[model samples]
Target: MTLYRDQALKALIPHVNDRDIVVAVYQSCFDWLQLNPRDLNYVAVGAMGQASSHGLGLALANPDRRVIVLDGDGSLLMNLGSLVTIANSGVTNLYHFLSANRVYEVNGAHPLPGADQVDFEGFAQSAGYAGSHSFTELDQFTEALPAILTAPGPQFVSMEVMPGDAYPRDYAYIHSAGAREKFRAALTRG
Candidate 1:
């Protein structure tokens, strides 16, 4: 069985404290992270396919802090070139996590082209990421997450996850301009 997205998020949470910035794409990732809310800083990049790039910027700008990219397969496919740039940017604090569920779950469950055949980890390696991993099982994911989060990297972890249940559309509002202002304010307050 594939890892569930919510469980994957839970496994990662313990390792992430308030100082870490989570740049996640779309509703599912944002909503799941909200399950056990804390004063965790997050950016819900409302646009699909933009989380990696946006997270890269934050990682580069804040080299002292860890930046996690909670990306999706469809989003990654849309901006594969960002991987090349990220690999070369020398940002060791960035951890890229792909929720590779194979379908664009938000877009009415549209299956991504070649999603099953794509070697996402290999692509990251080819782009020169210092660490590249793929996990399809929950045990492996749990076992690897701590090290992945703690290790100095431009780490790329591709998780083959099962699609989560539908969330309300209002979940998107968490990253609205006002919310972004609040997120910015929180980061600056630190």
Candidate 2:
């Protein structure tokens, strides 16, 4: 059975800390907000595939901190070039996580093009990532997360998941200047 997105994210909460900068987009943004709301969380709104780029920037700027990017399969497809850019950027603090549901979940769950054929792990590995992993079982994912999160740089993980609990979408919050300001203030204070 495929992992549930919420369950996977829930498993991640204990591993994340204030020092870890998390960049999330679209569905992951909403789910993360609901599950682990924190000032260090950077919600990448109004962008289809920029979370990884943002995380890369954060990782580069704060070389001592860990930057985790929560990205969607559909969104990643839009910015496939980022994999190569990230792998070559020489930043070892960035961890990229792909929630592969094989659909545009936020856009009414439309099936993604090449959904069945895409090999995200292969793409990341080919693009020169230091490490690449795929997890379809929650037990394995949970057991391996600690090591993965602690391992040295530019790691990519593709998680096969399905929709989980429904979350209330706060569009106003995600799209507002207040949200950006809040994140900026928190980041600067850190």
Candidate 3:
């Protein structure tokens, strides 16, 4: 059974904390904001597939803190090489979560190319990630999240999900300079 994106993120929220830096993009950003709005949340505005790259930078810069990246399958496809870069960078504190809804939900729910055939977990493992997991059920994802969060470096989790209708897409907030400034201020405050 396909999980709902919101439900999947809800399962992950409890595992996240104040010190953890969350880098979110696209539809995931909207849902995450609604679920858990925090100061350390870095919303990737206009950068299609750079959430993982940004999370990698944050993880490398702040080795003491964990960096969680909320990425979309369609967006990840825009820069699949990021998986290799993240794995090779040797950042153990980064967790890359891909919401694989098999479509570009933000762009009017268009079907993604090779959506059904793409093996995100395999790609990460082949790219040299320390661990990789794929979950299609909420129970399995929730049950495994804690261990996954604590396991190893450059972990990849692909959750097979469906589009959720609970959250509004606040495009203006995500693209605003004020939002960026807020995140910057939060980081600097540390």
Candidate 4:
């Protein structure tokens, strides 16, 4: 019952309110976000493994709306400390979604050593997250997501996904500054 990356993301779509701010990192998430075209504000972080920290900041700054962090396993591993920070912040509206495909899916689907060995959910719990869950199948994820999203938490959800296509080259135009300005503008307009 291996879930594909796209499937896991698709399952999450129904739970997100249009007003939630999404801070996505890595290629797959960016690609998905582009295709979905949400009216919700989005901040795309170009740097690898930085989305959690950025999402934490955004969650803290905008405590009213949920802050969805669409992150990847490789990226999360790169900054495990961010989990600690997020936990310590005690932000109730932060929803950390880690797409664990066990590879750097954007970079030609390269294998990520020890990715399968790490217990990301346990790590998050140990780091003091209010809630944490892992899913390998889409059905259970779909059933559980709405409650998880609505619950008061700095919740952590680690979904195991089968790697999919690399991000399309033509859709790579969004960068850090532009993304920041766009998200900031959206925030200001409200």
Best by lDDT: 2
| Candidate 4 C-alpha lDDT tens digits along 61-133 | 8899899998888888889999999999969999999888788877777878886588999999999999999
Ranking by TM-score: 2, 3, 1, 4
Off by over 4 Å in 1: 38-40
Q: All candidates' TM-scores?
A: 0.92, 0.98, 0.97, 0.90
Which lDDT value does model 4 have at 82? 93
Runs of candidate 3 with Cα error greater than 4 angstroms are none
| C-alpha lDDT score of every prediction, in listed order | 0.82, 0.93, 0.91, 0.79
lDDT of 3 by residue, 98-120 (tens): 99988888888899998779999
CA lDDT for candidate 3: 0.91
Model 3 clash number: 0
RMSD (CA, Å), candidate 2 to true, equals 0.8
Score candidate 3 by TM-score against the native: 0.97
Between candidates 3 and 4, the TM-score winner: 3
By lDDT, is 1 or 4 better?
1
Candidates 1 and 4 compared: the better one by TM-score is 1
Better of 3 and 4 by lDDT: 3
- Say which candidate scores most in TM-score: 2
